[model samples]
Target: MDFEYLLQLILNGLFVGSFYGLVALGYSMVYGIIKLLNFAHGDIYMLGAFSGYTLLTIGAGVIGGQASIAVLVVIMLIAMVLTGTVGLILERVAYRPLRGAPRLSVLITAVGASFALEYGIAVSFGPNPRVYPVRLGNEAFTIFGARLTYAQLAMMLIAVALMIGLDQAVRRTRSGRAMRAISQDPKACLLMGINVDSVITRTFFIGSALAGAAGVMSGAYYGKIDFLMGFIIGLKAFTAAVIGGIGNLRGAVLGAIVLGLLESFGTAWLGSEWRDVFAFGFLILFLTVRPTGLLGERVTERV
Candidate 1:
């Protein structure tokens, strides 16, 4: 590929990867805390985009065309908070009661939750895709002959900031330390007086919040939102979480960027239609070679 084309592909990969990483954070965090795969995660992401769109439309109407950019930011914050709350409710209603049930049962529950959220959204929002208003400007910046829009840059920045903030929280705060403890040994942590349930719930909140933010960002950048938007991206994000190491937060982010780059290059070299195949091909290769993932710790097989 030409240098300019290479640069452009890299930029696109980073832009898309950031959102993948953001969504994957939820997967990684939930798995770390409870070891249950929240299959409805992608649906939650789709819901977030709808929530953002709704809030933005309402803001636009209430504030009129002359509203300042700050007003939009406030609306987005509200949307994120609302979406995060929904995520918490999902965990409570759909998953919590089944804790420690057969893995197969939980998996079925996850699938059911996924379908419920998707169809529920379809019923409520209709099957049609909605367009997100152009709240962010369309200024392009050139770097190394690669052009990037302001919205892309903003999405990247926000994703990075959230990741960094989460890193600090997990590594520094007392609540974060408790969360880590529970991840390492939920039974032991519960014995030690750490509220295991609360920690797990909080993990979901944080992770889902990140996914919600990504939803809004994706909607703004792509100018479209639909019930199925999360399906492919959610699968990709899960692949990213597994590739990086499901329980490792930083690994999730790193894996997402790598997957994004691989997909971008694959699409450029092969064809867009082969993107999903290429992704799954890599996933299978990694599973065969290193099932624990790139950064996942090796666990001793129990008898």
Candidate 2:
């Protein structure tokens, strides 16, 4: 095997893994806070991509049909806000009322919400894949014969930055403290004057926003947006969370990177057609073995 080709695959894995990590953060956060699997979370990411598509379409004329990184950033911010609001509203409408209900009921409700979001977009968007307005050029540079696109590099930097910022905020901020406290014990947090429901609402919002930003970034990079696009990535992200130990923020990221590499190597070994098969097979095997995951289920570090 050529060493340069191996390095290229690694780079590709990291790129895709970063996207998985962003979406996985949402899954981990929601699970950490409320122990909800939040099946609808993936559709929130789909919403973000569509929202960015809408904004880009509307603003394209205003910007004279030219899109720059700055323009994409603005669109991404707007999409995040939109998706965050959707998450907050979803929490209020779908999940909050069932707070004390049976876990199975809540899980069913989550599945219902996922279907609602998916078909809602399909009905609105005509079930057709929408092409994004912005498409990054394939301009690239090479290091030791491993190619790196300017767009990939920029997007990776942004993803890493967002991940780091979230980690810092969770560790250092007042809201972060409240989140951790509520995660530990909602009743105790309420006793301590921490608004448990409020923190949870904010958690859903922030987590959804991260997923949204990822959606927009991915849409811009790939140049296509479809209603069902989130389904596979969502599963992969969940696998990543499970692999790294769900509810552990850093663990989710680490798991995503590892999964990415696994997929990359698996694809090379078995071809693209067998890639998903290989990855999902590994997931089943991993769960049957070490269910606690790489970092273990972390209580204090869940956020």
Candidate 3:
């Protein structure tokens, strides 16, 4: 095996893994706060892609040219806001009502919500893949004999920046403190006059916004938008979250990057068809052995 090829695979893995990390962050955050496994979260990402597609198409009609980076950024932000609002609405309309309900019932509702988002988009956009109006052209440069595209570089950088910003927000900000506190004890937080519901809504918004940004970036990078795109990535992101420790933010990122690298190497060894199998197989192994995850701390719940 060629060393250069191996290096290339590693680079590609990191690039894709960054996206998994972003999506997993949402899963981890929601789970950490409410212990809810939001099946619709992935579809929210698909919505963001469609949102970006719609905005860019409109922008193209007005400008009569490929959207500038600035316009693209604006489109991404708009998509994030739109998706974030959708997440907030989902919490209020669906999850909020079922808060104290059995976990299984809530899980079922999440599945229903996921299906609703999926078919709703299908009905609106038609059951066909839509090409993105703005494509980040494949302009390549070499780094240490590994070929890298300008678009991939930008996506990686943006993803890293967002992850760093999120880390800081969770660590340093008042809202972050509230999130942590609520995660620890919602009843205690409420007793202290903290609005638990509001904080949860905001958490959903922020997490969904991150997923939205990821979707827009993905659409630009891949140049196609489809309603079902998020389904597989959602599973992978969930796996990443589990591998990194479900409720740990940094753990999700670490798991995603590791999963990406494992997939890359696995594909190189076995073939592309075995990639998912390899990932899921690893997930099973991890569950059987180290279920707490690489960075996950074992929490004892009071009976």
Assess each prediction's global lDDT (C-alpha) against the native. Answer: 0.83, 0.89, 0.91
RMSD of each: 1.9, 2.3, 1.2
TM-scores vs. true structure, each candidate: 0.94, 0.96, 0.97
**Candidate 2 residues 1-303, lDDT tens each?**
899999999999999899999999999889878988899988999999999999988888886554777888888999999999999999999999999788789999999999999999999998989988878778899989999998899888988998999999999999998887776788889899888988999999999999999999999999999999888888888888888888788988998999989999899988999988977887887688877679865335232
Candidate 1 local lDDT, 74-135, one digit each (tens): 65577678778888988888888998787679879998988888889899989998878645
Better of 2 and 3 by TM-score: 3
> For this target, which candidate reaches the highest TM-score against the unseen true structure?
3
Clashes of 3: 0
Which model, 1 or 2, shows the larger lDDT?
2
> Which portions of model 1 show Cα errors greater than 4 Å?
63-72, 299-303
Off by over 4 Å in 2: 64-66, 298-303
